[model samples]
Target: MTRSTDSWIQQLSTLMGDFYQLLAKMQYLDLDQGTIDYPPYIDPEKSVDTILATQLGINPEAIQLLQRLPYVAAPARWNHGAGDEEFVLYGCFADFRKDGELEESRDPLYASIDPKDESVGWEDEDGQYMRPWYVPLSRLGNHGVVLILNMKNRHLWVIDQEGGCSDPGLSDVDWNEDLVNKNSLDRYPSRPATEVLRDLMQKFISLEWIPGGIHHGYQHHHYKRLYLAHGWPDNFDSPAFNATRQVWEDEERAQYSAERPFQDVDRLELWTQLPTISSQLARCEAENASPAWHAQFQGGSGRIPYESRKAELLARLPGEQQRRQELLRELEQARRDVVGVSGEVRRRREERLRLDGR
Candidate 1:
């Protein structure tokens, strides 16, 4: 007797679920063992299946996929980085409910029509000729990319932030391409759910295990060591993985540069305040001067006489004032130097204009 392909697929899916469960346990222990971890807020007694069924009201297949992949509390908000959001593998289906009530008029034509009514025809209201299922696998900040499935079709579809579905067989390519393109929300159809999960896992490993700017957090290095100790999968070293890593690295660099301050004005302001230090010190002494201050300067009591410490502080005040005057002179000179340089630049520009006029 031979096992069918579906049987093998089912076995692999079960193994995947076990793997995710281990990953989730590791997360609870605050160990960096894998690319993703289960959300800490999830109740241990409630199975992932139960949570999905209760929260999303999705089908068994969707629950199975979520169990295999698991949801993670993302370090940053999803898409656009605007709000706190979780990255989870789950699907949503269109409900025939309106305002908390199921609308009988919107039921499937087969369910609504009478067996003998010839006038009633099959009407597809949900589109795709079947009920649509939206499965969001990953999100960057507040932005999301969801896998759209339908009962009528075996092909998987990718829907982006803009609500555009990718062309058939081009989901992976379009997803990668959109990372660099201005229209980042364009989507396409891809392989089956299993293959899509495999590909996404590969990409996640590369981004989360490999050293790069876009890696999730500082703990990635630790997870990389753990993966190595546990042994990485044979398919981990693919060209596609490397290409995706490069794309994430480039995007991370761009985001970092865009957020960085190019010119910091605070340093200039500090320099401008430097000359006032002597006056501030004098004011502090006048307001808080006491035998305690003398003792503090003398390194606790009796190290030096109070009169001697007072003389020392007084002696330092003149030097501080002198230094302040010198700094003010230097600042004035710097201003004059800047004016001279600006005049020279203007003169050179005028000379160039005169030459150009000739």
Candidate 2:
């Protein structure tokens, strides 16, 4: 990039960094309460809402507690039959515990809830779960949690201003210095964390962080805050850390690429961009009338006939099922979200009316 563009980028990065710091300070000072009123939200099940309220000591509308993280996009290419185009954002504050490898070097921070061994539950009949949890992508100076509220495949993810990915392995996670450098470019690519996190955070803050609006009218909510424990647990040891590391290695591969062969497409930029292009292709293909249109000759009829060879090739494509399923699920969720949100609004309005003796 030209020197002039580079200088502008540096200025922008500095400004964003400063803004991030300001947001952190505001959160610490509990300024969010004054900026927004977190009323209790309504859950699909009233009993679930009650339990959430009891555990959180606030209405469910007030906060959301995420248990697991999924991929905003999957890794571009890994050694798996899982397509090289997609990337997933899964795991808890998992890698931070890095087999306890970094504990000796840096103080070990723990999650409020112990990571459980039970199967992570799904929220839908298709065995999909849509919990909005914050997944940290980097340990950027270890100041705060980098989180994304994956709102059940809705419009977009809601991200926390202070939360970010802390994982060293994630391609999206970058050194702060690199971010500053990129900002210098005319078409400076956004630091993956900043772009992804900032976009998600805005969505989360504006939509109340629940995807599909399923929990919109609920009167209670639960949000998990990443906190620094005063001290580490006495029982935390290498053996436990080793076990956790193994679990991450085994589970991350198994969970996302279980049916596919694993490969090495874990780079962030490639993974994020490729799948998007692929997905659009897939959608266009699905809606297109003739599958063999691509093979048409220069002077051939636009009315191309279906070709078996092409159909076979598509059928053999990797992650075809998963991709189609993801899109369908998102579409379905969008519909349900509209209904759920509207119902909650009506429900809340009625409640207000009753309270006013209407």
Measured by lDDT, the strongest candidate is 1
The alpha-carbon deviation from the true structure for residue 175 of candidate 2, after best TM-score superposition, in angstroms, is: 25
Model 1: per-residue Cα lDDT over 130-237, one tens digit each: 131333333322333345433223345555444455333363463434333233222244566555545544554553423122234333443454444443453343
- Clashes within 3 Å, all models in order: 12, 65
Lowest summed lDDT across 10 adjacent residues in model 2 is found at 223-232
On a 0 to 100 scale, what is the lDDT of residue 264 in model 2? Answer: 22
Please tell me which predicted candidate would have the highest TM-score against the true structure: 1
lDDT of predicted model 1:
0.40
Give per-residue CA lDDT, model 2, range 151-255, as digits (tens): 222112222123433322243634343332221111111333435545533533343332211122322121111111111122224344434434544654454
Give lDDT per model, in order.
Answer: 0.40, 0.31
Which runs of model 1 end up more than 4 angstroms from their true locations? Answer: 1-45, 48-141, 149-155, 163-187, 206-358
After TM-score superposition, the amount by which residue 168's alpha carbon in candidate 1 deviates from its true location, in angstroms, is 12
Off by over 4 Å in 2: 25-198, 207-358
